[model samples]
Target: MIKNFHQYYVYILSNKPNGTLYIGITNDIQRRILEHKQGLIDGFTKKYGLDVLVYLEMYHNVNDAISREKQLKKWKRLWKIELIEKENPKWSDLSIEWND
Candidate 1:
């Protein structure tokens, strides 16, 4: 349960538990997560049904978040799985859906 407000985050969204990962960086984590959840943005994410918030890392600076996002993107799938498992063992979606 994340309660802190932060500026930037390196987040991973998935189509399902441990399925089809999409890595991204965002300043407004909640809003961006919501957007993906609702399929509001049309692209690879929307196409792949990448809505589950499997992993996230908050950062105070955009540069750090972007760098982390890039590094994660370059990593092999196994490495990404290890990184996610280190924090989110069950691979659960963290987004608290605010939609009515």
Candidate 2:
């Protein structure tokens, strides 16, 4: 028997500190972030220039990740900001160094 491992991500992107935010979930965080950065995603993130990865959560189950993403999307803006700030006080792009 073989066991397969999988990962899912719930992520938040912002243009800058205290800026417009976009929430999403993906099985591949790096690829998803790259797509957003390259403007391949034609929606809120691209329109708002929200390429900075300010917050992220990982899950082993895709369903859990999806649920969390939906929950975050429904949260108040201030509450979301607080959640991001709790883990990323500077609102820096967590994926900034991925290319290098």
Candidate 3:
């Protein structure tokens, strides 16, 4: 039951690995992450502070997903931060319907 025809997505949220990071794919990106920020997900995202929409890349095909993920994974901490800042300078949560 995926929506928008976007079967999945490749996203990067900065909390930390197991500490706060949220790397996942979903058709409804905005809604899914909003759930995380609201502590809706009873997992690592809630335990840590991984509620920020640090970085996100869209892909029409899964191969792009695999490639981009691998690229991001190898990036340095500063590099990751820069990438997020490029689009989300404030590090604000881009999740709509998600309240602070």
List ranges where model 1 is wrong by over 4 Å: 1-6, 97-100
Clashes of 2: 0
Count clashing residue pairs in model 1. 0
Note the Cα lDDT for every prediction shown.
Answer: 0.87, 0.94, 0.69
Q: Give the TM-score of candidate 1.
A: 0.86
Over 4 Å off, model 3: 1-7, 15-21, 38-43, 97-100
TM of each candidate vs. truth: 0.86, 0.95, 0.67
Write model 2 residue lDDT over 1-100, tens digit each, in one string. Answer: 8778999999999999999999999999999999999999998899999999999999999899999999999999999999999999999999987863
Candidate 3 per-residue lDDT, tens place, 5-40, comes to 444577877664223455666666778777877789
Q: Which residue pairs in model 2 clash with each other?
A: none
Question: What is the per-residue lDDT of model 1 for residues 1-100, given as tens digits with 9 covering 90 to 100?
Answer: 9867658989998887668889998888888998988889999999999988989899987788888999999999999988888888988778854453
Clashing pairs in 3: 15-20, 16-20, 16-21
Clash count list over all predictions:
0, 0, 3
Which candidate, 2 or 3, would have the higher TM-score against the true structure? Answer: 2
lDDT at residue 12 of model 1 (Cα atoms): 92
